[model samples]
Target: MEDETMSNTSEKIAENVLLLAVARLSMALSLPALGFVAYLLNLNLEQKFQAQENKIVAQKESSDRQANLTTARVETVERVAQSAIDQAGKVNERLISVETKQTQESAASERFQAATLTRLDRLQDSIVGQSNAISALTATLQADQDRNRPPPP
Candidate 1:
C-alpha cells in the first residue's frame, strides 16, 4: 500500500510537469510570429510617415512656385501700366506741340495777309500819281503850240 501511493503521487507530478512544458513550448513558438507581425506594422508605419512627409514637401514647393508666379505677374502688370502711362504722356506732349505750331502758323499767315494788303494800297497810290503827271505834261505841250501859232487867220 505505501508503494502504490508513492507511485500515484509521482505520476500526478509528471503529468503536471508535462502540461506546463507544453504550454511553455506553445508560448515560445508564438514569439517569432508576433515579432514578425510587429515588424511588418512598424515598416508600414514608417512608409506612411515618409509618404506624408513627401506630400508636405511637394505642397510647399507648389505653394512657393505659385507665389513666385503671382509676384512675376504683378510685376509685369505694373511695368506694362507704367509703360502705358509714359506713352500717354508722350502723346499728350506731342499734341500740345502740334497745337502750338498750328497757332504760330496761323498768326504768321495773318501777318503776311496784312502786309500784302498794305503793299497793294501803296501800289495803287503810286499809279494814280504817275497818271496825273502825264496829264499835266500833255496840257503844257498843247499850250506852247497855241502860243507859237503864225497868226495867219
Candidate 2:
C-alpha cells in the first residue's frame, strides 16, 4: 500500500512540471510574433512616408516647369510687342521723309515752271520785232525798184 502511494505522488509531480514547460514555450513563441508584427508596422509606415516625399518632389517639379513656361511666354509676347513698336517708329520716320521730299520737289517744280514761262514770253516779243524789221526792208527794196524801172516803150 505504501509503494502505490509513492508512485502516484511521483506521477502528479511530473504533470505539474509538464504544465510549466508548456507555459514557458508559449511565452517564447508569443515574443517572436509580437516582434514580427512591430517590424511589419514599421515597414508600412516607412513606405507611406517615402510615397509622400516622392509626391512632394513631383509637385515641386511641376510647379517649376509651369513657372518656366509662363516666363517664356511672357518674354515672347514682350519681344513681339517691342518689334511692333520698332516697326511703327520706322514707318513714321519714312512717312515724314517722304512728305519732306515731296514738298521740296513741288517747290522746285514751281520755280522751274515760272522760269520757263518767262523765257517763252521773251522769245515771242523778239519774234514780233524781227518780223517788223523784215517788212520795212521789203518796202525799201520795192521803192528802189520803181525808181530804177525805165519807161515803157
Number of the top-ranking candidate, with TM-score as the measure: 1
lDDT of 2 by residue, 1-70 (tens): 8888678667755765675466456555654655565556557656765765565556556655655655
How does model 2 score by TM-score?
0.43
TM-scores for every predicted model:
0.45, 0.43
Q: Can you give the lDDT of residue 25 in candidate 1?
A: 62
lDDT of 2 at 121: 62
List candidate 1 stretches off by more than 4 Å: 1-80
| Model 2 residue 28 distance off true place after TM-score fit, in angstroms | 3.0
Task: State in Å the error of residue 85, model 2.
Answer: 15
Ten residues in sequence with the least summed lDDT for candidate 2: 144-153
Clashes of each: 0, 0
